[model samples]
Target: MCSRLRWTISSDSLRGLLLACLLATCGDVVAADPAAVGAIAVVVRNDSSIRLMTRDEVYAMFVLDRRGDFHPLDLPESDPTRAAFYMRLAQKNLTMMRALRSKLVFTGAGRPPQQLDMPALIGRLAADHTAVAYLPASDLPAGTRSVAVLQPSP
Candidate 1:
């Protein structure tokens, strides 16, 4: 004779399991193909006085390090370019970046850059020469020029 056992989960346990699965799947959403994602460019208005930026400077600016007179603009949280920018250049994932920004805001230290859509971000850069941002190299607008081209790590 053969015997079998059955198991059942409570609603709370089912919800928790589903949540864990969702989080696990959503984590590390960065694109695996570098070519598909394209290199990211740290950019400023074409006529800005600030010509170039080092990798460290770019990373600091994005992380709200209180750098020079530049205002760092951020793409929307759901944008793939935003994910690539943080993952490739800053060596950080969205979760870590969000947590850091939250802590900074809580402690009254600093706030994350203003998130904007592509058109609004481009407009801001055009209007505010102090504005700096990152986007896929191919998508860079004529009003902006790349200060630094950050390639993905091998």
Candidate 2:
């Protein structure tokens, strides 16, 4: 009886462990699928003379590498939309981006883009024709026009 009871308990524990592992792996798979999330839009002020930009141009502008007449605006680091924007458009995660920006600042090569909340970002874009930013397609404000849609490569 004692041996039988031990076997039953061991089997139950193994089943529970397997279940936990499956659940964890499934969550990771879902999160890794970019199609599961909304698309990101690179935008400029509606009245801006610049109508188009390539992915490289957008990336350079964001990283403060290619200085142009236009200004780049960023959402706060904690915002998920900002994270998605960097990941999709610039092929960078927030931690990597921060490290790069820090190195640039330390070398006096460049500074990070100005961070703003959603409302302030919208307002600034509306008023400044030279300003550029990225936001979720659904969340783009009225006075901004999407210059490019950034998506994961299939």
Candidate 3:
């Protein structure tokens, strides 16, 4: 609880400072939106050739220690995002995602997620039907059907 309060204070102070700075210079703080920092879903292309999956399957695809649940994708051993991804998504601290990636890559466990911008990820999802990527609904790519939106796990 103490940590939570400290974090709240830190984030609030940072956000408020940013807002104050923005208001003093620009007309608004929207040039940098904090809401943009959240977990986006990693979606796959909806190819009939590939099997459809549930959230369980998707989560299982990444949760490394799960029995009989090895990652189906060929991930690098030094992926920098491996641990942080788990923390941000699994642990639900959005700020930690990049840090996790840095740690993974530095340790040579894996590489970061292939940087597919929203449009690219969506287009691939529509055509491949077997690809998975993280994207927010508000920033969804074209031609892809959202089976489920990624929510903060309670």
Candidate 4:
């Protein structure tokens, strides 16, 4: 009887552990989906003196159709946040943007923005007053300030 009782308790404990693990994994999956969240913010160094920009202005800046006093910094193409930012703000996918930039560079008409990963982007923004980049709202570092809040398109 005691052995049967021990086996039953062990089974219940194992079930509880499995349930806990499943719940934890689900939470991580939801958090990993950027689309499940709200919009990202376009930011510059805290000490940057640039004014807030409108959607069109930001689009032009990203596409190299216009120039601004501040240098533009881009997230690496493979970054999920970079994909979201371009889709929401620039109205272009990464492939389209890269093709356009390549054509411009080939013609000597424009140069592409400097590309960096999250940590490097944040560090550069903190040190370079002329640099601007977009990051997820949650990822914005303390030394940066949002110049524009980019909403996702309908």
- Highest TM-score among the candidates is held by which one? 1
**Judged by lDDT, which candidate is best?**
1
Q: How high is the lDDT of residue 50 in model 4?
A: 76
Question: Which whole-number lDDT from 0 to 100 does residue 124 have in model 2?
Answer: 89
For 40-96, candidate 1 gives per-residue lDDT tens digits of: 898889899888888888877887657577788888666778877887866777798
What C-alpha lDDT values do all the predictions have?
Answer: 0.77, 0.74, 0.44, 0.73
Q: TM-score per candidate, in order?
A: 0.74, 0.72, 0.43, 0.72
Instruction: State, as a TM-score between 0 and 1, how close model 1 is to the true structure.
Output: 0.74
Candidate 2 off by > 4 Å? 1-36, 152-154
Ranking by TM-score: 1, 2, 4, 3
Q: Which stretches of candidate 1 lie over 4 Å from their true place?
A: 1-35
Worst 10 residues of 4 by lDDT: 6-15
**54-148 in candidate 2: lDDT tens per residue?**
88888888875564788788876556777777778667776788788878778878766767778898888999998888888877888788998
Model 4 CA deviation exceeding 4 Å by range: 1-37
Encode model 4's per-residue lDDT on 1-154: one tens digit a residue: 6666643221122455867686754542212343544678889887788768788887878776475677787876556777778777766766787687778778978777777778888888888998888887766799888888876655
| Candidate 1 residue-pair clash tally | 0
The lDDT of model 2 is 0.74
Local lDDT at 27 for model 1:
57
Q: Model 3 residue 118 lDDT?
A: 41
TM-score, model 4 to reference: 0.72
Question: Which pairs clash in the backbone of model 2?
Answer: none
